[model samples]
Target chain A: MKETLKLFKIGGGVLDDDAQLHRFVQAFAQVPGRKILVHGGGKGASQMLSDLGIAPQMVQGRRITDAATLDVVTMFYAGKTNKQLVALLQASGVNALGLSGADGNVIRAVKRPVKDIDYGFVGDLPANSVDAATLHTLIQAELTPVLCAITHDGHGQLLNTNADTIASTVARALAGRYEVELHYCFEKNGVLLDVNDDNSVIPQIVPAQYQQLKADGVIAAGMIPKLDNAFAALEAGVEKVVIEHALNINEPIKTVLCRS
Target chain B: MKETLKLFKIGGGVLDDDAQLHRFVQAFAQVPGRKILVHGGGKGASQMLSDLGIAPQMVQGRRITDAATLDVVTMFYAGKTNKQLVALLQASGVNALGLSGADGNVIRAVKRPVKDIDYGFVGDLPANSVDAATLHTLIQAELTPVLCAITHDGHGQLLNTNADTIASTVARALAGRYEVELHYCFEKNGVLLDVNDDNSVIPQIVPAQYQQLKADGVIAAGMIPKLDNAFAALEAGVEKVVIEHALNINEPIKTVLCRS
Candidate 1:
């Protein structure tokens, strides 16, 4: 039987560990589907740029990417992130085509100023701009699409974006064609109900419980954004999401989130 | 009578037409100093990248830059050719400094990769890492440092470079020092040189030369690289480079090169 088509969201946490990324690429090469890999270059890029005398400014953790920062980010994301991922996947025998949202008009976006405050060079991706025909061509060629968080204004200019959001939008664009699954992978052992306790695991979150947790503050702190995006995917029509604990790398377990 | 520190570069030909690059970011703000800018983009990046899509794999001109394309050239010369120009002049009136061969611990270069082989990133600059002192403290204080085409290897990550390399490099690094002079303002009347007339009475290159002659003959296409970079600087640099004709941008034009 053929396996399900999946849309994987490789998190910043997974990218933080180079070794795990290497191993994950190995296993992924052995898998199926017209896989689209999207990545986040958090801390890594900002830190390097900072060390080089750049202090990042953002309205809400969203970097106010002007021109200089854009150049640096391009080096990190397009030049470093995508390149490394391509190298790793290629090493593992995967035919991966690394790309930016700008190439071949693959994905286009509108420059978004931050909440009425100009974020200089930041952008918001439009749903219609996600060109599915271009993507189909790549999949038909049997090449894996490894993407970075950066995009373009389509006039030869690039924009900074949240990688996870990019993956979500991409998944949303590509749903229903196949058994599309967006795997949000991180370095944790799974979603932990109790933060302090490592062994505690929350196997699933149904629609009602997902809402209740938000009401009762069971899911407060940082988990808010992740869950919000997870649910956004569910609402957008992806088959389901597997928020797995990618700690061991080899032995990945599914902490599924079903909408019911 | 001493005047302002005016920057003047001789573009390939495009700047001849687009003299608007010179007046873009308020030239009155430049700190009082002597200036002469020499630029080259060869008009290759646009046509060349486009050509590579169709041409055979010729190692020198047609080979596509893989993740490996950036290895040597992106880091080192990106600054030398592109970003440094943007980072250096883009906020001139507002204190965007200049950078080039003479700056403190600037661009370091690694040798070209093996002719046909992928060379791991090369080129060495004095400070691969931009120190807080340069981007933040220094420029904010109203000292304009004009950087020629160059970048550093920060921590041994040497890079190949091109002129007008880091187009928006300066703008992003020093967003606070907003204004910039990226593409086009030059001494020449713009790209207007005689293919056969050689009388040189035009006083400088003009826009007409950019379109008319380009189609007629190759016009020693090697000169295309320099002009190519000047155009990129507008988008890459914090401000716009007023690329004009070479003869009048500044005084004391380097006679040998111009008279060639």
Candidate 2:
């Protein structure tokens, strides 16, 4: 049996609040074992962009990443937020190494192709994008890696990538060498059966049940893509997938997704 | 016998110019042996701060790093400049790892004490600040570490620091294990006998000669502190300190400072 590696990803909600971010960091540090952290860009980046007078570029309904927006997001995610998390983790006795994808050539991505819209500096990860070997060495050396949502093409262009995609891609890449557990921590407790009720979290979710739930309108439209992505990670041999509140990661009232 | 390690420090001259920075990166990748790169923040940070309406705080002619200034500098130095260098180096076939002091707790710092001047969020590195053992491990693994001018107090505050100080401090710390060569690269050819003549590069200067040059009014008052810092590094066991043009590092026409 291989060693277990827990990979936790947090989104904008926890990151936007300092107190909540610190609380999450404390909880994350207490998770005993080899672990990794992936963080998304918060309102800070967008706020900075707005302050700098750079308007958001939207094509249809989707926000497109322009050159200026890319610059701001890169600074916020990789520079401020990443370093802050690393320092906070260090204070809690975890030797956290912060990284962008360009660091150690950990993740090489390609710029998204122009189809109907040209997302100026957005990156999309393909197969074999993550450098699993180097990451394995870092983890085995007792260093917890904290990755930001910034990647680069091998030819010197930095691109903004989706944090969830990065987390799942890394987990999938490491699945062959370790029993990987992918955790998505967000504002909500878990995948709630009733959207309005906070106490209606489904404890366990499997593929068949998930499909049935979607078909019967138990899961909403917004959650389909997320669940699909999670199921894909499970199919790729990740041991388990988890969805929980960023602040209550240690608590048991969360949903766990298994292959069975 | 320990291996030779070359540590190069580059400032705004190269960082502000894209062609010059890429040229330096190409040159850096071709150099043989274990190496590290420490870069100073460029004018982009200040420009961004200005555009964002944050006025720089100054005290008695020296720039003070207040909270807002610290935030912009951190994002610019650690985010844009560091990642850009890393990506360029990777494209040149070097496995470059970008770091702020907070990453891996590699360099812990203390907030500058408020005395006659309150330099808000500025950090001062004390003894045993650099984690040389971890650096040695990274170098041994054949990864070139690129550090920016951002550090952290172990209690989670990211503080802006001086790049030259960071470079020299790292050189002094790593002197015990590696025969270290510290190079400070800038726009000038070298220390000049005639301040106005770019071609009058002084080949070498020892401590005694440096003092005499100062007394003779040959060296400018501004160059005194830099030379003093370089000589201190030599006295602290750093093998050599070189000052040269950033783009002309591979050329031989430069100044080498010795402790003798």
Candidate 3:
């Protein structure tokens, strides 16, 4: 039996709050087995941009990542946040190593093609973008990689990427070698039957149940894309996908999606 | 019988200029065998700090690394500069992994003790600060480590460190395993006999020569600390120390200091 690798992704909610982030780090450090952590940029980047007087550029209601925006986010995500997390993890005895996609060419991305909307300096991962072999080597050497949502074009350009996509892609890439479990940790408990009820987490959802839930409109509209992506990862060979609260990762109350 | 490893240190002058940095990256890419690059913060960090309205704290004419200053420098050095260099190196076909001391517990440092002046968040590396075994594993895995001048207290506190000290210490730590050559790349051609003459590059300097030059007041006051560190690295088992221009690293017109 292949050893299991749990890849956890945290977003703005946990990252933006210092106490919450530390609590999450302490919880994450206790997770056993080979693990990876992917983190998204927090509100800090936007705040810094605002403080520096760089206005956010948007077109057609979609945010554009200009050169200045990219620089700030890169510093915030890859530099300040990532290093801080690594130090915290190390203090917790997890031996974490922080990385951008540029590090070791772990993930090479393609710049978003200029459509009617030019999302400048943004990257979309192509197939085989995650270098699984290198990651495997690092993991085998007993190092836990903490990746940020920054990728490169393999041609000297650092582009902003989505952390969720990075988590799924890395899970899919490593599926052939490890029993991959991808965890999307956020503020909510899990997939709720009643959106207002914090205790209404659906423990398990296979592909058919997920489809039914979506069709029944039981799932929140905001969670549709995330669920769609999770199920796709399940179909693509990832053993399981878990949606849980960042603080309660060790707890049993969560949603698990698997292929039936 | 040990394999050769070239460790290069670059300071603010080259890093602050894009063209010079790219040129140095191109030259560095041409270097063969196992290598590492340690870089100092550029003017960008101070610029960002100023833009963010974080005033530099000083004590008795010595710069103090206050909490605010530490955060900005960490973001600047570990985030923007380090990632940019890694991406550029990746573009140049080198598999580079960026690291702060916190990563992999690579360089755990002690918080500088409060003397007459308290330098908040400044780290002082003691003996065995560099994890040579981990570095060896990374080097043997074919990944070139690109380190920034940020370290951690191993207790979740990130500290600002000097890049020159990091370079010499790393070189010394790895001396037992590799034929390590430490390179300090800056603006000058080499250790010039005449401070104003760019062409007066001293081809080689031994302990005796260095002493004579200092006694004769031929060496500039600013070069004393750097040269002293380089010699200490040599005495500590590093094979040689090279002082060269960042843009002209692959060229031969440089100063090579050796223990004789």
Lowest-sum lDDT 10-residue window in model 1 chain A: A245-254
Clashes of 2: 0
lDDT of each: 0.53, 0.93, 0.96
Per-residue lDDT of A155-212 in model 3, one digit per residue for the tens? Answer: 9999999999999999999999999999999999899999999999999999899889
Q: What does the lDDT read for residue B76 in candidate 3? A: 94
Range of the 10 consecutive residues with the lowest summed lDDT in candidate 3 chain B: B62-71
Question: Could you say which candidate leads in lDDT?
Answer: 3
Query: Which ranges in model 1 have alpha carbons more than 4 Å from their true place?
Result: A1-3, A58-62, A114-116, A247-252, B1-260
- After TM-score superposition, the amount by which residue A81's alpha carbon in candidate 2 deviates from its true location, in angstroms, is 1.2
Compute fnat per model: 0.00, 0.83, 0.92
How large is the i-RMS for each model, in angstroms?
15.9, 0.7, 0.4
Looking at model 3 chain A, which ten-residue stretch has the lowest summed lDDT? Answer: A206-215
RMSD of each: 16.5, 1.2, 0.8
Better of 1 and 3 by DockQ: 3
A best-first ranking of the candidates according to their TM-score comes to 3, 2, 1
